[model samples]
Target: MDNGKIKHIGVFTSGGDSPGMNAALYGTVKVAEQHGIRVSGILKGYEGMIDGHFIPLESQQLQKTVHRGGTVLKTARSERFMAVDGRQLAFKSLQDNDIDAVVAIGGDGTFKGLIAFSEISKIPFIGIPGTIDNDLAGTDFTLGFDSAINTAIESIDKIKDTAESHNRVFIVEVMGRDSGYIAIHSGLGVGADAILIPESGEDFLQLLKKVKDYRSEDGFIVVVSEGDELGAELVASKIKELNPEVDLRITKLGHVQRGGNPSAFDRMLGIRLGAASVNALMNGERNVMAGILDNQLKFTPFDSVVKQHQLNEELYGLLKTLNT
Candidate 1:
């Protein structure tokens, strides 16, 4: 609760790795330096925190990382960190290193872990929404969502080329385990014929009818989020059964969407949110996530941010209208 009690800040990325995470780390380091606060890089997220994997980071260590993807400090999912004993160990590690606070970058799972850790330790914690899913409740857009959508769009564009050449229906699957943000945005961006998301349960018959309607067209593209009711495989199977004579292919754009240089928007968002996280901690904010909502930076309680994000119905309707 005392701002002066925080002299050294620890930062780490956990859960799924995403683009622009390094930019966030860089921004945190640079801003902490400006504020004369020491920065310690916690390698491999909470696992590192438990093992006391501490490294002093300067502004020089963050050189040229803005354009880079992934985290310079690395990331991991720690089952051990979930236990009370493990959290105690993590707190001891922080105390041993003289780290008074933390800036964590990752998705909902990361925040959940931070909340658990906070119950056992007094170190203030600030979270940055750094996930491709864009499924965090507090933020309008997460740090890596923009770059991830762009990556999927680029891959969809390439698949469209071959789909057209072969006069085939390509079922393209994108990441977003429980949300449709990536599928909706990339689907609209690539002008897909139909888009299936987890939020709107897949209607196989409806999809079949749409494909049949577009049969005479040059080619067809259906964008499906991996978490959809009918995944790419099942959807493709149903389509094949309905139209055995139709040329159909399935393309799952897996981890590729999580890599590559972050887009301009993501880089800027990461930097801004990263700096905001440090400022929040210095201002005595704890157990909150730093994010941008309505183009303004803000902090939300960790409990609220970790809740399941509702799908944007307006954007879903726009996708339908545009596709139709």
Candidate 2:
């Protein structure tokens, strides 16, 4: 609606960092240039927005980074961005720089920022889905999910090696705030004997039953989500009571899953989604998120995109039955 003459725009990654962020930045920059738009990349997520931390971007600034992992633009969660004063400051910074629009690359929390931001400034902004959790509602898949899942699987595989050698029950803990896509996919990918997730919580006794049945003199591998009902250490202790002879260990994958080179799938998807986001902006879709909905790529308002959504029930049930 603005005649596609976007003079200046901004890009920032808010919320947790993940692989493929750099690719998204590259895509956004390249596509914006194609439309004769001047783009600036923001660092440290919304903190950068509040502090006016921006690097004016040119196509050369993002050339050939499509295969790289992590956000070259950098990221941070601004607790500041959540407040009214902070949000106002952020808008001031954007205005000071003459930014006509913004592209936010992050998950639900970041989209919530978009909602607040649009209400305050009425400046056009588009969201590019980049969270590894894949929990964002509007999109079929987020950009970083493939890389994160691969990282989780690799961690589980390595932990299993040690578990088998020592005949110990290894509980590999992965990151998944609420949705269990990562835990479930990684568990099934690596054939984890017992997988625990927040969505499918059980009391200690019930959990013990599953662990007991899956445990053996040869040891076992149990995969747990950080947001699971109980910590892996506590779960291991409970199993120890059921079988005193069983050795146990826990591998908290921690931020390691957020590290490393992004998988090819993530990079390419990030590029396409990033470019599509800019196109969405050109199409007069502001304060919206660009994502794959139903089978086609499209845009949705940030508020709608950030709505609380959960894992596929069918997949959850399948994982439960398979684990049992």
Candidate 3:
């Protein structure tokens, strides 16, 4: 391969770490190898970009990491990247290293960083959504989301078995900072008596009333997001006030949802997205995200993705009706 014709592609994992990141990296590297291009792994997200923490990513090493959880390339969040000085440093790193393009594996916040980096250096970027939150704007499904929901429901199912045996009222909290995808899906899958999310904005008192009604009729199981406005302790205390004999309890599934080997669905999506990102770069697309649309790979410019896909209304509506 002519050295002058060889392109250097940089890959990084940013924002909240999730499973399947390594798989995406593997796919990108494998596809790039077909074109005689070299790949570099940037550690610790954009902070690594600023500090130049990177290593050569060979196809051999990438193959070893495809089945792994979390990123082989470590991740970090740096507020510095939001500023001019930081962007300058990142651009300087790329120019010095001859990086021709970047494939960013992250959620919304990291995608925003890619947009900023592109604006500063005019470098091409392709994003693969890889967060457990599943809150990324444009994608119908984000990598690690299915795995997370599966992890959460496993816990929920376990809790359900115990709650059923004891005839108890248990509230299991899952992860979802602002989105309800995890809680809603897990609740629906496991037949949760009630599901609470940020979008629902259901009042604590009303929630208590519903729980009380459930207890009166039969035992209850609720799945709530950790970001739910009301804390589990607060809800339990209010329930006690209503009935001193109530056996209401809370189990917060913190970080448990983000762990574990990604299920089959996530691994497949990771492969598809990872390959699609490489195709986007080869096609001269820059500052864009690759996502699955109608079971097909599709590309959307970052600006349009940010504006159009945040907080999907149709899915939210279905979640609401399911709760009812």
Candidate 4:
């Protein structure tokens, strides 16, 4: 890590907003200010970069921010930023503002934009994992994952009361269009009778068997990830098709899981990684991501970081055995 030419750095959040993003942003601003590196908040992520939406940042701007969810700077996914000209325009704006380095907080799409932008601009970029999906590689837990699982658990717990009262089967759906971290953890936490995730390879038939096995029970819960190849709706349809006499319902937690104050673990992770990103740039590291691997802080090159697998097989197995 030897390229510390950064005098001023711009920070932004992009892609889907996560609960701990503001905590990370606060960490970056505070640490950068202490080191005498001028800081600017790039509004709406890359769109702000292209549009020149920058606001001077100091510790005061971040006061009382650690307890908040989403990002103080806000976030967005930019299609224009995906184009070469869009990136060039963003670079020109950075130059005009005297920004020398950048730190972005978000998930895979966020990193992809940073990687492409860094390729054409001398200004180095670093990424901080900030999504609740916990699907990205290189880190054990993404910033908002713990908070999201807890939110889902709370919602499902209430829904369970209805299921029990009506003596009906409820197939609850949680987020994870590509990954099942939310489903696996929240389902297990609430002690669902069964859980169905895309990666588990537990097909519709397997789920059908679980439903039947638990038929003697008064009521039961089945947790399903949205990305499950079998699809949650199809699972419901099939169940009703075979067990016509069964009373059933479906609840999709939706964006509600994305809200709520970040959990303690997420706050610590966001602040630590946020500070680490600033340190990494000062140490001359670029085109990398700040990650916590095996409880140790590390800087992984963005290319390799995004390619790593994130599923926790050990927990998945425990969910299956214990829930039965």
Task: Compare the candidates by lDDT and give the number of the best one.
Answer: 1
lDDT of 1 by residue, 244-307 (tens): 8789988999999999999999999888988898898888899999988899888999999987
lDDT of 4 by residue, 1-324 (tens): 223477898999998888988888888988888887888999999999999999998877685888888888988889999999999999999999999999989898888787888789989888899998998888888889999999999999999988888888999999998898899899889988788887767445566776664555567788889988877788889888878778999999999888878899999898999899999998888998898999999888888877845578797677668544
Clash number for every model? 0, 2, 1, 1
Sort all candidates by TM-score, best to worst. 1, 4, 2, 3
Q: List model 3 lDDT by residue over 192-211, tens digit each.
A: 87777776665454566665
- Ranked by lDDT from best down, the candidates are 1, 4, 2, 3
Superior candidate under TM-score, 1 versus 3: 1
Q: How well does candidate 2 score on lDDT at residue 116?
A: 79
Clashing pairs in 3: 44-74
- The window of 10 residues in a row where model 2 has the poorest summed lDDT is 201-210
**TM-scores of the models, in the order given:** 0.96, 0.94, 0.92, 0.95
Location of the lowest summed lDDT over 10 successive residues in candidate 4: 210-219
- For the record, the alpha-carbon RMSD of candidate 2 to the native fold, in angstroms, is 2.1
Name the best candidate (by TM-score).
1
For model 2, how does the per-residue alpha-carbon lDDT over 201-224 read when each residue is reduced to its tens digit? 643455577666454555577778
lDDT of each: 0.88, 0.82, 0.81, 0.86
What shift in Å separates residue 215 of candidate 2 from its native position after superposition?
6.2
> Which is superior by TM-score, 2 or 3?
2
RMSD of each: 1.8, 2.1, 2.3, 2.2
Comparison by lDDT, 2 against 3, better one:
2
lDDT of 3: 0.81
